[model samples]
Target: MSGANKVQKREADAEPVPGLFTLVLHTHLPWLAHHGRWPVGEEWLYQSWSACYLPLVRVLRTLAAENRRHLITLGVTPVVAAQLDDPYCLQGMQHWLANWQLRAVEAATMRTASGASPASEPKALRQFGSREHTEAERELAEFDALWRHGASPALRELLDGEVIELLGGPLAHPFQPLLNPRLREFALREGLADAAHRFAHSPTGIWAPECAYSPGMEAGYADAGVSHFMVDGPSLHGDTALGRPVGDSGVVAFGRDLQVSYRVWSPKSGYPGHAAYRDFHTYDHATGLKPARVTGRAVPSEEKAPYDPARADAAVDVHVADFVETVRQRLSAESARIGRPAHVVAAFDTELFGHWWYEGPVWLERVLRALPAAGVRVGTLSDAIADGFVGSPVELPPSSWGSGKDWQVWSGEQVADLVQLNSEVVDTALSTVDKALARGGSLDAPTPRDFVADQILRETLLTVSSDWPFMVSKDSAADYARYRAHLHAHATREISAALASGRDDHAQRLAEGWNRADGLFGALDARRLPGR
Candidate 1:
């Protein structure tokens, strides 16, 4: 075989290489279906589903069909999974996609009417509109044939093929570090069960929301049947090449290799900022489509250049090469430092690939295909754990992969009221439900499930989602976040009060009404709730 043929043969065959590389993508969104739209709501779900979920999953499926093993590990969080499987969301998403197609035609016909252009402005957007219409049509057809059932089957297909390892998280993505221990345990257990119910397989690994940890969380992990989880590199503080057991718990904590992860995304800089990539913030207001590239940090949205796929693809190639080199160098350096083959984990939010960074998916495909050829072994987190990529127990401080590297993001002074309010709501919901349960067996007592209690639990759990406080603290949609939190709190309080005051008819009405709006986790039987 020629030299080129020899390289191709190596890629077509799987064998151990110099060092291990794993990519972890945490997939999550707050319960958004039927919650709101436009500025932030179900639109969020459909947009991610179309742009991120569809393309990313297809990439993995294609690779798996080629018999590639251990592509990546994914955390399809419970709240997100609920929305993905909800019938209302599936119907709503299809409608949104069809509308997207129609809107493209409208944009092409009415560029002057489309806010992105003026009568005097060149109709450069016709091309963008045409491209989007094609994308919309493709997604809509694919969705009809494959995704009508939900995201579960798509993900399970990958899991069954061993293309990915599935990691699940709590029902609401709560900040477990500061949450009540019993509630935290319940949420994790229920979250795992939710995944098993939807996908027909329980995840042995978990992507703890925000990769947050508080010393004894590993004990909770061991109890919950989680064999391994992830934390940021800072949590390890010394060496991050190998996974470490937390204290005495047998469960392992893999530390993300920041050197590798930050090469792709960070607070101040990353590959997404490349001038040729599509700009996330800029949009054509009329059609709600983005047509600009990140020309520069100071460029205004209107002044930015229109997106060029060819240019963006060139940038993707450069970045993919850069990232692959970064991985190879890091693996080589870490192996030398540890005196053994090292595991380098590059973890990122799944949304970045196609939503926030337009070229991310393409870059990912090239990088993954290129890495093994560079003498680096690529595999999922589970593969690392099973291969004994673990070290001695390490004492970890209470930490979260958020600002300031502590619990400040979720329980900071900036959102002290939310913190206090969360405590109150959690306490009230638990106590009220417990009291109702205790009064059971009497003819007057509420039935074992009452399901109104389920609403109280569901709505209260939504109230405590970490997204609210994080959004509030960041002031990024603070008002909307506050509205959602308060909405759930009111539902919990109203239903609890009705049940307490012996207004069974009124409580049933409220529960049924709320159930239509926020009914997720059909498997969540509130009678089994394990808290005060």
Candidate 2:
């Protein structure tokens, strides 16, 4: 055959590139609209917005501009989505961006006539600030253009344009394993409705809060119309080469392929630890910039090497090549072992990209582009299902992507009080709503909108968020986590107490007061809440 004919013959005989690769990014944050700012609360939201959301969206948009479809599955929790779309948060984000610009300008102009600091130090600070100022302006422009009206428009565009497959999760991202069954069902249904409200499309896949799953939760998934959900590899006994249909339900569970995933991020090593990457923890106090590279894991902040973008770009290229090879090899090996084309799923937190690792966005863009070029097929979870990446049905164990691959992170001794608090709060809130609805003389009677019941549910949901307990268990911002948990629990208790004691006026007032801070998910109807 001629050269062109030979190439065509080979293409016609190729066996679908061995397997498919799917990337799942779970994007979540607790509601922080009217929450406190500074070292803990809304600051977390704003920083992730600037560093992770804005840049990550830019990369995805760039890829979309190239006509890449089904790029990845992105899970935006209902709580985070509500905050992103809230007027309070939009205004707060604008102020945060403006303040960031001002800080950058200050650092850039801080050189004194006496030059108290070393000459090299001032030069580095000035350069860092100038670079940050330019990046900040770019972010501001992107935010105003695409995200000013909240993330809905931008996210909707991505969905409508088929740039990504969006995943929706339970309201407030409660740890489902421990929730009252009624509350769990209610939360998941309301959460899907919320996503549908914002994006005009209901998501069939969810990044289950912390990927926590319990036996028979697939029934809930089937009830909620969820087609697929993610779980950690251990949940499937590490047989993660294909999606397993849990029980008899149609809901499929895709386990993260740790062999391929840990190549980029794991406990001991990852690309982010490379010497050329920007250090995440070593902040320059004078300028508020992470001005150093990792250099050596043991190197102190003061002795770390200055961050060099060119070097970081070089590292990204190297890692991209490495990751592409890793995926290619894994897919080949797994396909051989499974005796068919296998699936490789790598899941991560979206914030880890730009917030935790500065060069992550660049590396992400490069690897995504490089994978397909290296003869590996890339797609979303939905695409995997469509392409026959599922296997025989397998029963999943109670599991989570936490310490010990179990529920201890949220239910362990460190958070035993929180577990009890959640239990009492959920039980009280449900009974109160149930009683109020029944007291209307007819259980099915049409009654006036129960704003008090709505607030109670809101507080109850907020109190049970997996974040609070996870934070306490991990000792990351434990004080703030405990404070939030207690605050929400108090609202749940006080509101339920007043309403249960025939103090209608007091309940309404308390509900209104809490509504200012915790009011979200306007679609949550107390009448729809099932009786315990």
- Highest lDDT model number: 2
How do the residues 134-218 of candidate 2 rate in per-residue lDDT, one tens digit apiece? Answer: 9989998998999989999998999999989999999999999999999999999999999999999899999999999999999
TM-score of each: 0.95, 0.95
For all candidates in order, the CA lDDT equals 0.85, 0.88
Tell me the tens digit of each residue's lDDT in model 1 across 1-532: 8654565677667344466899999999899877889788888888888889888987887677666779888889999898888888999988989999998876666546444322213366787777778888998898998899998998888888888999998889988987888778888899999999999889999998988999788998998899999899899994789999888888889988888899999998999998999889887777778877898899877678878889899888888889888988888888888888888999999999898887777788778777876667888888998887777888898888899888898988988989998899888888888887777657776556657777888888898999999998888889999999999999999999999899988998999999898999888877767754
**Model 2, residue 130: C-alpha shift (Å):** 1.0
* Candidate 2: Cα lDDT at 161: 91
